[model samples]
Target: MRLTRRDAIAVLAGLGVVGGGAVAVDQFDPPTAETAETGETGDGGGDGALSATVTATMTAAAAVVYPSQTEGVADFVETYVVGRARDESRRDAMRDAALELDAIARDWYGDDFADLSADDRDSLLRELGVAAADPVADGTVSERIRFHVVNELLYAFYASPTGGRLVGIENPIGHAGGTESYQRATMLEDDAGRVERAERAGDAEDVEGSEADE
Candidate 1:
């Protein structure tokens, strides 16, 4: 699904972003000094917007994690990241993770993470072993990236209507289809089919028992 900037906001709302869109998530670690130092001294200023570097790194990361067919990815990712970063702790963690990714990118490819090709971004993430690491707030670089960057982005996308459709979910949790949606005629039909099959099996068993008695 093609996501507009408005759709991205709705996605954040679905994730329980409230109080003027400060951002919310099911799990995250409190801000640490390390992360604070990373952001406090960086280019993300007092305007409450995410830093350009953080936005670029996150958008690049989302491209690697989202389906190749995903549309309007750059807008969706930037909106989500900026909104989510309203929480100071979350923002710091994201900034720290983005800086780590940039550091790695420069070390390996002599370029920034956001500047690397898509294949390179994917390769770098795999090399960091984020795919295999459990996300922890203060864990290793891979773990922090897995938590603050990759996993959060995945959650935001999959929880949105567009992303959920890719996986055959017509309505993800927060989008609101209502009870009628759950009352599909196909479900009743399946129940009836099961009952019919059970009756047929019961009849066949009864007939076999009678024949044995005879």
Candidate 2:
């Protein structure tokens, strides 16, 4: 199945990453720095952690991290990020990672991280050595980026139904199919009941025959 961004967002909503992807998608107005500073908005957190810079940075990262076929990358990442940033600590870490990423981008490419070309962004992440680093919330720049940015996005995707399916997990832990999942179990239960009834009937017939013989 081609993994669409909507599918990923559904999975995130099911996992409570965002309250509701549908609402977030339709009602989402990109937060400006002025609005964020005034604390007038943002479903993400009261502390205004879901800044425009962070949203843009993460969306750009998703374009690189997600499989090429995934659609609506920007919307999907923004929704997931807003929900994730609700936590004060997590929000702070994400903001820090975004700033650090931009700093690195300006140094190497003379641009913000989100403004870099896809190839350059990918190259920059590789240059930071995140693939080999141990993810640590309070570690070095590379480690923090790995923990808060790269690995964070990866974990959210893989844990969701869309990404989990790639690895042969039809129903990942968080996404239960409700009645659909119970269909097989229900069939087995009915079959067992029929077998028990047949056995009881046979036992009664044997007793009747034995009594008649005696």
Candidate 3:
């Protein structure tokens, strides 16, 4: 389920989002200015707000569902769900249906779902897998947010530098080095040919320069 950085983002974009442990419990200090700028280059929008009530509920159930959320789950849902609700393209009826998805949490556990204990959170999210997949609910705020959260967990593991190295997934960028023993031969051949051609061209230029000097 791990995904390289590109793959993780692509997966998140495709899922429209998934649970992120980072969003709920991870309280990772926001990246420094430079790193935040880097994260923003590809992700168009950023964080949003949530109340203490909503946050506590999401910590258990929602955080497990999404996994790497840290303390930002509320922000994510606000952007993707409420923002979408406001847009003209989003239907009022569908928005209402989406809101209803949270009923399960309120009715089953009481309070906002986020406030539950870790064990409760784990229990709730595990239960959600079967329920969230139901298309009717999946499109709503409840599962819709969870869907994104799940991707975040997968992304964190896969996008990590060591994660990529562990899985033998090559960086599409082709600059990062790989384990020597496991190197792909085709990679070396292609690089060698490119280097050889560049060297030959450099030598030709050097000869031409020398002749001119003479």
Q: TM-score for every candidate vs. truth?
A: 0.70, 0.65, 0.34
lDDT of 2 at 164: 61
lDDT of 2 by residue, 166-214 (tens): 6655445554443343345333322243223323323323322221221
lDDT, candidate 2, equals: 0.61
Worst 10 residues of 3 by lDDT: 20-29
| Candidates sorted on TM-score, descending | 1, 2, 3
Candidate 1 local lDDT, 22-75, one digit each (tens): 232211233346545664322223322335667778889998998888789887
Q: Pairs clashing in candidate 2?
A: none
Best by lDDT: 1
Tens-digit lDDT string for candidate 3 (1-214) = 3222232232223333322212221111223465576742112132222223332333334355444533444433333332122222322333333233345667777844555566765665566663445333246554554443443233443433323444555332222233432456443422343323323323322322221231
| Worst ten in a row by lDDT for model 2 | 19-28
Instruction: Identify the candidate with maximal TM-score.
Output: 1
Model 1 TM-score relative to the real fold: 0.70
lDDT of each: 0.65, 0.61, 0.36
